[model samples]
Target: AAAQAAAWLAGGGLPDPEAGLKWGYMEGATDYLFEEREPSPGVAYVRLVPVLRAEPTGHDLIDELLREPRSWRWDGHGESMDWWPAVLPSHREVVAVNYLPHLLYQWNHAGVYPPYLEALCQADGPVGDATAIALAYFLSTDAERGVPLLLRMAARGDLPAAAVGRQLTHLIRRAGHQTRPVVAALAVAAREGAYEQVWEILRAMLPGLLPGEGERPNVTHTEAVTLAADVATWAKAGGEVPATVSAYAMSKRTSRFARECRRLRTQLT
Candidate 1:
């Protein structure tokens, strides 16, 4: 089904803005098909939005479509078949009405968008998973917010532990923070057992306190050591321990500190 859609788009069968298309496999079909059409404009727009599947071709199709020199205009009905129209009186409105929802729906249905949009968003620097999370956070509300954000954060292995930890701590300190809710949201990623996030949080927070001071009123080294140990254990078990752990350990000059760090690294591995 996806191949057919790609061939169609590649062959220049422009998308009917009114009749959205889902460009991947469907229930009983091998290739992609025009799955649904809604009577109402908004509904139809949401229904027909194309979600690319697989690689190379999926990516190629999107690039081709985006590059087509067309000023897209959405009719009042929220659908337009024309690739390039003379007047797009409501460019912003058309984008919001016809494009934004589809982009968001792609995010919701495909787990993530193609690298093109993701790269566009992070073009300035290493935005990492935060870019994806921020989009999801804005598109979704309340209960749906943290789950997607955390998932993206977890996937982007390049994120520094310190940065992730700080974000997690800040979120936990927010007025509405609830342990169960926060932990539950994070648990999915945690189950992947990548302790980089846990370590990242600890590494970020530990340096902020005075030598003997704890992060929060009741938190203590015992707690810190325990959490660190737990993270180390999980990371080692999952074979996802960051090389930084050993590097940080080896860079230390103090014999005792170096020994402890090495021990921690060993434990994590």
Candidate 2:
């Protein structure tokens, strides 16, 4: 049925301008069916009915049909299916249904710093934070566009800062810590001195590292302890860590790691 439909449309089996078909620019029509028409060489009047429907089942049907070799042909033959009647609903439907929501979820976040950190905690798997971070970083190059998206994600609590930071670190290590597009985007944000934006991305991730059953694996007690010490040292040197940073410092940890972080912070200062 699908192949016959496709073949018929390709052969102008339904209607044509010479057939005086009046489809009236249907928005979503895969093929046109000729209902009534006056056949003439130079003068013909035909009324066209859209063959494709917009219902979900109809979409599935079209998808199945398009995948079949028998339903479509792309050769340069006369009246080829290549330029036959337009496909219904269009490619925009595919993006709207599948890609855009996932993309928006990942991209509209704090930024790379926190999201990266979160990625480190996930077990090696396909649907991990790592994938999200990679995608967000790819899309983050457009600062004007990307920054707002990040902020939107942050506002929505879709991403956290610590996670982002870890992800960034992972990506840095993967890229040999050298300047790549993702790093460059961060550098640009840093140079622009968008500290609030940077902080938000970072702060969002901090809650995940708090002492709890769901605490992330990447942000171990030792790392958290060391990070706290680093924050203090940075603070003493007139650098202010976000409130979330200090909050994370209060989590449970080994005394040795805690002491070591504090010692490191002091030494660094």
lDDT of each: 0.38, 0.35
Q: Please report the candidate that would top TM-score against the real structure.
A: 1
Worst 10 residues of 1 by lDDT: 84-93
lDDT of 2 by residue, 79-123 (tens): 322221133222212211122112222233222233332322221
- RMSD of candidate 2 to true structure, Å: 21.9
Q: What is the lDDT of residue 148 in candidate 1?
A: 44
lDDT of 2 at 226: 48
**Residue-wise lDDT of candidate 1 within 124-243, one digit each (tens)?**
223322333223222222335444444454565533345445434433332122333433433444555546675555555444321332322232333444456566566653333334
